[model samples]
Target: MERLQKVIAQAGIASRRKAEELIQQGSVKVNGKVVKELGTKVTRNDRIEVDGIQIEKEEPVYFMLYKPTGVISSVKDEKGRKAVTDFFPMVKERIFPIGRLDYDTSGLLLLTNDGEFANLLMHPRNEIEKVYIAKVKGIIDNEKVRKLQRGVILEDGKTAPAKVKVLGSDRKKETALVEITIHEGRNRQVRRMFEAVGCKVTKLKRERYAFLGLGALRPGDGRALTPHEVKQLRAFASATK
Candidate 1:
């Protein structure tokens, strides 16, 4: 037996967190009976339906996408904008991005039908590092860099310490390439961090997620995660837990 939300998530219907929302919203039924309790568990022999439709378990598929700017990092965009899933036209599984990238920021992103895996990696306790390269409006002085390294205060709260490195700068353009490594997945975190220090991010791209990078793949291209890579990711996440 497994938790109902876990089962729903593994079926590629939604992330475990989203499945809980579905359950609470009275959209989930098991064996023809609405089951709203989050702790409810079900056996393989039981029938699970979400939104009045029975769920089918799909073989989990993992993919790494070289997400491009101007694409939304969602399964589908309500406004008909291009989404990360649009690149996987040949994939039949209901895969979703593990987390997300800003619509205007591009780089390495992971998509998968394994919601449990997604939850594990997105959980803040796991502290998975993500690295970003940002082109800012001005050359960041040592003091501003130190402030970011020490953690800056944002409206939401104080940000975690980030690894900041000034890759280089163009004096004529007054633009500097700053690399930032952070574990927290706050909304527009890199850009916000620079803004908190009086610098504006003109362009940004994520270069790495933990140990994964966008090898030679061009923007909008993707590849499957090798079995070994999946194992390593799971092991690392579990270890951090």
Candidate 2:
């Protein structure tokens, strides 16, 4: 027997963390009865249902994609816009984007069918770092850099401390290139951080996530995650557990 969330994850329904949410929403079942407890366990002979649909176990698959600008991060969008899932028309397993990248932002994006792995990487408690490069309006001075490194107040709340650095500047264009690293994954966080400093971000791209980099992959290109890379991410996830 194994934990309910693990079963759902291994069954290719969703990530373990999302599985827990499904259970709490009363959408999952073990045998005939609804199982809302995250710790509930079941054997292989047990039947599981999610939203009244049976789940089948399958091998996990992981991929890293160079998410191009204008591509949505979700599996499907109601507006009928192309999404990351559209990039892999032939993938057989039910993989999903680990987190998100905005429609306008471009760069590295991870996709996987392993729910536990997805949960681990995206969960804030794990503190996995992501690096981004942004082109912002105006020059970034030492004071602005210090304020960013120290933390800035946002509409939601004060952002956590970040690692900030100026990369380059184009005085004629009134633009500066900056690199910022943080562990949190709040929506358009890097852009908001710059906005807090009176700078408007015009272009933003994720350079690296954890140990993975964009490397030579071009926009819309993708490659399977190596065995070693998967192992490292698994280690990262298990560390917080």
Candidate 3:
């Protein structure tokens, strides 16, 4: 037997956290009975339904996408905007983005049907490192870079110390390219961090996640992860866990 939420997650219905939310919202039923308890467990023979649809386990698949700016990182968009999943027209699994990038931010994004894996990577305690390249409105000096390295206060809270460096600056344009490495996944964090330092992020792109980087992929391109890559990611996640 496995936890109901785990089963739902493994079935590609949602992440384990989202699966728990569904259960608490009374959207999950097992054997025709609504099961709201997070601890509920079930056997393989049991019939599980979510939102009136039966669940079926799917072979887990992992993908790396070069999400372009102006695309939402979601399976669907109610506003008729282009979504990340629209790029995967041939994929059969019900994959979803592990985390989201802003509609205007672009770069490497991961998608998968494995909810447990997603939870492990997305969980704050894991501290999976993400690297971003930002083009900001003003030239960043060594002092501002030091401040970011030491951590800065924001509305949510003080951010953790980050690895920051100024790649280059254009005095004529009054802009700079800064690279920052952080583990937290706060909403629009990179942009907000710059804003806190009196710099506005004019453009942002995630260049790396954990040990993975976007290699030779252009915008709107995607490919399945290699077996070795997946193994390495799982091992890293396990170590962090």
Question: Which window of ten consecutive residues has the lowest lDDT sum in model 1?
Answer: 8-17
**Each model's lDDT:** 0.92, 0.88, 0.92
Q: How far is candidate 3 from the true structure (C-alpha RMSD, Å)?
A: 3.0
TM-score of each: 0.87, 0.87, 0.86
Please give the TM-score that candidate 1 achieves against the real structure: 0.87
> Model 2, 239: alpha-carbon shift in Å?
3.7
Tens digits of per-residue lDDT for model 1 on 9-67?
88767778899999999999999999999999888888899999999777788999999
lDDT of 2 by residue, 81-150 (tens): 9999889999988778988999999999999887777877887888888899999998889999999999
- Candidate 3 structure quality by residue, lDDT tens digits, 1-241: 8899998987767778899999999999999999999999999889999999999877789999999999999999999999999999999988899899999999999999887888888888889999999999987988899989999999999999999989999989999999999999999998999999999998999999999999999999999999899898888877886
**Candidate 2 has which clashing residue pairs, if any?**
15-115
Candidate 1 wrong stretches, greater than 4 Å: 1-5, 12-30, 33-46, 50-53
- Best candidate according to TM-score: 2
